[model samples]
Target: MALSVVMPLDISGESAKYPALFEKMGVDFTARRCTTPEEVVVLARDADAIITEGSQCPIPREVIENLNRCRIIAGTQIGYDTFDILAAAERGILVTNVPGYCVEEVSDHAMALILACARQVVALNEAAKRGEWGFGPHSSHIREVIRARMDALGGKTLGILGFGAIGRSLAPKARAFRMRVLASDPFVDAPVGQEAGVEMVDWPTLLRESDFISIHAALTPETRHVFDENAFASLKPTCCLVNT
Candidate 1:
């Protein structure tokens, strides 16, 4: 008998490729758009393996306890915060995630957001649509537009909240634009930061000094709401933030 693989999430349209890919690998794959823990428990109880997008379909302790024959719980995304790793381990099931899947793509998006914010691209585009060219003394918001600063990326500081793979990828991209990169990660050491060509700094220093800040940290008990009121208050008035 072929091994059974179950995906307890809605895998449609573009995601339909997964079924075909699994077929080529000779696994008996089933994609069920499960919306509840009960649904997952029913569908994956006797499966050999389970694959899911961790963020969308949470596999809590209760669900893990019901996966009788599952040998592995594979999260197709980088973060697997939705799964109960301890519960899976207790049941002899391995929990795995794809950390390198979107490193470059996510870093590129962060850079795009940083540039767009620095130049006020969206605001300018809206103004242009409203027939405001932001010049020649005829525009109503000329003062605001002129005071937008819209400074170049050269010589500005960029602080990254995490020095993980995505953050490491972003450092070189920021350097290419002549920006100084700083990073803050309680788990990362100074030597690791040095190797990545970023200055290791505390959160306070990063908040105070960076002209642009990009958050690349995984959501956890410690990092949840890390940029609260106090953090925002510490930032430079002109600082731009990008969270991805």
Candidate 2:
């Protein structure tokens, strides 16, 4: 009655954990990169526990319907829209994910992206490499690159799409920079974000007033491609967009 766990992506801790707890529990959870529908179906149907990555390998309705043993699924990261939780629940299955895993690392990543875009890190680094400093744009395509560096995060609004762990972590960073934080997360109450010094604003206000829009939403049927053409059209042309 060993629990077999299958992974869609590489789990960070393996050599240390495997053959230790798993071996002791009689659970031989072999983590493998999911490759095909057949492989997914076979592993998922047989597994008592499953750990998935992103939306790439969808645990389909057939898999859920036919699976006889699967009872628990733990996604490796925050987004579990790939797995059919409703179906899992219908079958009395417990589906879980790591919501705030590496919160600081993610916050640091978002800030790095934001700052890189703001400071034109690439363009300037290239300029310095070529024995050029405070250099102007080389072409019309890049004429606006330097302007990105001069822009201030202060006196501007930072709009976060989803107020999950990453969003919560970003608030203090934005506050440190003297920027006002506005976030939208239908699932999270306004007070939750407000406690972190972020004012929860509606989508329209976030779009209109924000100088920087950061996407932290979980991808779903509703949210997939949410940042498509029309959304971009709605954004202020000068607004910088960062995603994590």
Candidate 3:
């Protein structure tokens, strides 16, 4: 008999190609979308593999305990915080996630946010829409505000919170704009940062020196709300933050 797969999420339009792809691989599987835990328990009772998107549903202890023949639980997100790993492991089920799936896209989005904050793009566009031309003597206030906020990217320092795939991808992009990059990741080695042309620094050093900071760290007890009141008080008043 072929393997049975159950998708416990509403991935209709997004996963239109999954059926064809699995068929091409000669895997005869039945993919069913279960929106709730009760539905999942019913549909996946005889399933061999369970697939889910991290946002829609969480694979809780109850769900794991009820799976009859599940061997694997796969997530389409980088983080598996939604899944109960211990429960799955106890049931002899492997948990998997795709970490490097959106490295470039995420890095690009972070860079775009940094650029938007630096240039005050939204404020300027709104001013233009309100019939305010930032030119001549009458617009001195606008020009002064722009001059006070806008700074060139070259020679600026960019600090990254995590030195993972997305952070590594962003370092080179920052360097391309003639900006210095610093990273702080307890899990990564100094050599990794050096190879990516980023200097490994302490969290305080990165916060104090960087003109812009990009956060790429996962949400954990240690990293959750790392930029608290004390951290904000240490930053430069002109610094911009981009959290992805």
The sequence of per-residue lDDT tens digits that candidate 1 reaches over residues 119-212 is: 7788777777877785645566745754456789999999999999999999999999999999999999999989878999999999999999
For each candidate, give its TM-score against the true structure. Answer: 0.90, 0.85, 0.87
Write the residue-wise lDDT of candidate 2 on 1-244 in tens digits.
6678666555566433654777787787776667776777766677787767656566756667777888887766777887788888999888888887788888888878777766688777776676556435544324555554557677878899988888889889988989889998889887788689899988878888888888888887877887778778888887899987
Error of 1 at 66 (Å): 1.9
Which segments of model 3 are wrong by more than 4 Å?
A: 12-14, 23-36, 136-141
lDDT of each: 0.90, 0.76, 0.86
Identify the leading candidate in terms of lDDT.
1
In terms of lDDT, the poorest run of 10 residues in model 2 is: 134-143
1 against 3, candidate with superior lDDT: 1
